[model samples]
Target: MSSASAQPANEPDNVFRDPAFRHFWFARLCTTIGYQILTVAVGWQMYALTNDAFMLGMVGLVQFLPSIVLLLMSGHVADRFDRRIIVRTCQMVEALIAVAMAVASFSGWITSEYIFLFVALLGGTRAFETPTLQALLPSVVTPRQLPRAVALASSATQAAIIIGPALGGFAYVAGPGVVYTISAVLFSIAALMVFTLKLRQAPQRLTAPVSVKTLFAGFAYIRSNPVLLGAISLDLFAVLLGGATALLPIYAKDILHTGPWGLGLLRSSPAIGALVTALWLARNPLNRRVGRVMFGAVAIFGVATMVFGISTWLPLSMAALVVLGASDMISVVVRSTLVQLDTPDDMRGRVGAVNSVFIGASNQLGEFESGVTAALLGPVGAVLLGGFGTLCVVAAWMKLFPMLTNRDQLHDHSAHGSGKAATAR
Candidate 1:
């Protein structure tokens, strides 16, 4: 699956022109939709079962725990193994989990306790699949088209996020079993699409022997590069502080006084905003002042979160979420471009794993934090506090990581032998 070998003779400028990327993109969309649906159904079911914010938080925590424990090993494996095989296997496992859950739901055997166990399984699959998929992306398209490819991928994900929850909400009218079954079918289709991809995975990196240092190479690489460290940390803390997703269920039920369908709409609003932004970026890619834009977008995200937190009007809250998503999309595109372009081919898997961990922590762990805070200070107070905290983070990040703030171009960095070079590796 070498790029040279897989590249079509008549390739066009657009990433969508690449057949391999088309299949990969479709695969990603299906899987993302399945995961989003599963998330909504599970979250709603957990809340209904226990009526406890903490338990809903626990759902996120359980899924994230496995990734934390296996983070280093997963990166190592992604670097060493055939990433396609790894991804395909994980998708199969996820499909099985979905099927099992569907059967359990139909049989009235599904419970909050078993759901935790199932979610843990999902987490384990994610631990390996995320890095492998991240590393695999570059293999699908040429380096010149990487930015557009990333944008397209982001758009696909946002589209799935927009559709999945709404579909899940409607499906729920029948039963959770139906939602789970649909998810399983989508996962199966995603797996098949992955199987069809023609990627040229890089040869496994074997420069160093297996050791603690080698296992944790991704962390070391990120830590040594102030720019990369700041970029990653900014996203880590900003999203952790600003994330309002975990509280959405509470908002849908208590605050907005909406039913399951309304909950679906609430969840989908951010994705709608994000999808539009992604499409815009795909056409007009960022070329300058990348760092400043990222910071500005994050600020906007925080403000939107605060607005959503206080608004009693459903339309206002939804609109705020739309802005939040749009702002976050800018940050995502900038950060992802910085990360992928900065790292060498050999280290993409490891660094990608580290990035995935940061993302999972910001999202999953943030959910847990929201739940705990909600229990203590009520959902409204918790969201408002998070929004304020996000603004403070932006101020701190600008000062602490002057290199990031000073960066002007996304693809102009020379990978310093250490990781801070002003040009791509």
Candidate 2:
């Protein structure tokens, strides 16, 4: 039997079967679900308290700003220390923040200001956690399976995105306080799961402590690598313009004319599409013409966003969002796999940190952009313009970053089992 045919149909044989990867995946899912639930609860609390659109925008800005500021330092810490320990510590901090939010909510002390503070704290943790997690994944799986592993991870996260908000909305109707308490419990459980994982320690460099020199080295690496720089920039610019998540409440309230339940569905539509695509990728890894596929997918995402912006019908908007989600997932998987496949192990943390900065900037900056645009042009105009802008970015990036367009030709150097190639600094 062929290798693919020999695999169990139910199992869909992939790198996910690795015990360590499975443990990591499950832990990630638990934390993500909790975080999503907390997000919805906080948004509900903020809306109930201030009822101001600008304040909502401010909440997102507060979180992203801190994350961008701290991301580089966090990456240095990840490289200088044991990544397993860093991840566990971050997870514990996340659990504590979740607990604190729950307590604040249950005690009738919840306010928009409090939510902002809490979110900022969580964002700080994420700045550290994201780099470490991204850097750590390759350690748990072989290079040949990196793409599959990434797809599985993305799918798991998207699954949480789909389920978490839906659950949060239902919980919110019961009470934001109750939702927060449940989120807290879930976070605690996720932390405990991280604590139980047996992770390999990254070799410590026999060099001076982390300093400005070390920080700049990461930047230098990015500046020197055209392919890496290109992939990162494509994602950064495209998502920075295309992301409309921050303005969803406006759409739900003004455009869709639905309440909290409708808002949840709108929030989840993309995740539903992403989850399905990720599962397919996990089962059938893409090994050919990945670059062309990525470009086409992102262009489709832009078109879908444009369609979504013009649609007033809830179902039609949701359909557009689904396409947007699926196309975005393709871009995400392609870019992420490229990063992992090319990065040296010693530099993974710093590189991942750089990626986090782009991610943080894109998401937070996107929120800021959406808020300002919506304030000036109204929500519909803002979304339509944003989508159109994303299409232009796609074209610009294709011309500017030829490496991304030729991504399929790139090889996974990490698969050769040569520690020298895999761990080169």
Candidate 3:
């Protein structure tokens, strides 16, 4: 068995016992909630200033573009630097950006253009921050603890999705400036918490040479590993095809005959389901038959999406969404644990960057895809097709990546190489 399969030895079972992991978790929580709040505040402010629906779309585009444009560089930087410091530095930068936004907003000098520029900067910092933070996790807790750690960490994000926007909405009553101020304070706390962390890392990772080969090394390494490629791409395609979230506003309004309050429940349902499921997994993990479970979970996700699509009743729609979210959480935990434990620590950053790209692309593109499809096919038709398409993706993945389909345990197959050896290929 590989070290990834290493059961708890002397280390405690509760991940929070390790003060390092505890700090890491809190930092994750703070940043996730802070970012969520900031996102709501910024979008609201931009719309308030311009009163243009088109500008709202640009806000997302400006934020998302940086992650794609800087993917290769960000990955390499994560592998070459002190990841803890990288994470802390990025958070601090975000805090300053938030503060600047608050000042500009309160001063009544902020423009939609300025807001776009600020978010673009925020996106760039996050491009560095996300992958470095992912790579930093295994160092925070022992290998045996990583599965639980990922689950717990996921729970934090889900909880934040529920908490942040609602809090931001309430704060927006005071004005977007108040929301920005709150986010800045949260980002500062996250940075300080990250600063307090002490990682038990492997040997110092050497800086890879800055060449075309090194720049694309993460992409190359993932391609060479079929299991890794399968897991990551499965997530990409599943979310791409099946995400009905973009059509939720339509579903709430046109199909369900509901208003803003109904839309809120529809949106909250998935996050609530995901949070509960993540907490459950944190307490009781699924180590055995991981690949099969992942496939089943995704299949459930597809089914739930279809159920949500066809349902006319509000309660049924929300229930399907809850199932959709819980199932996706299971797949995410499995995929995240597999990706982290299977990759070499030296290459984790670069690989994580690629993973982030896929994730970001899936989300942004998924919403776009849903919109295009909805326009062509009615919203119900669009969602149903997405659900069915997700199922097709699952079937295709199982056939194309039998190694992934046949995987027995989450932690059993890892035998990673050094960065030098990995890059040499």
> Which candidate leads the pack in TM-score?
3
Ten residues in a row with the worst lDDT in model 1?
Answer: 416-425
Higher-ranked by TM-score: 1 or 3:
3
Ranking by lDDT: 3, 1, 2
The alpha-carbon deviation from the true structure for residue 392 of candidate 1, after best TM-score superposition, in angstroms, is: 2.3
Inter-residue clash pairs, candidate 2: none
Candidate 3 collision pairs: none
lDDT tens readout by residue for model 2, 14-53: 5676677887898789888988888888777888899886
CA lDDT of each prediction against the hidden true structure: 0.85, 0.79, 0.90
Better of 2 and 3 by TM-score: 3
TM-score of each: 0.87, 0.87, 0.96
Kindly give the stretch of ten consecutive residues in candidate 2 with the minimal lDDT sum: 414-423
Measured on C-alpha atoms, candidate 2 has an lDDT of 0.79
TM-score of decoy 1: 0.87
Give the lDDT of residue 10 in candidate 1. 40
Error of 3 at 327 (Å): 0.5
**Clashes per candidate, residues 3 or more apart or on different chains:** 11, 0, 0
C-alpha lDDT (0 to 100) for residue 374 of candidate 3: 94
Candidate 1 structure quality by residue, lDDT tens digits, 1-425? 58556865444356787788999999899999999999989998889888997898688778889988989989888877778899989999999999999999899978999999999999999898888888888888766677778888899999997788879988989999999999999989989999999974454353666888778878888887777888899999988888798799889999999887788778888988999999888778887888889999999999999999998888998999999999999999888878877776667778899999999778876776888888999999999999999999999999998888988887764653446341122
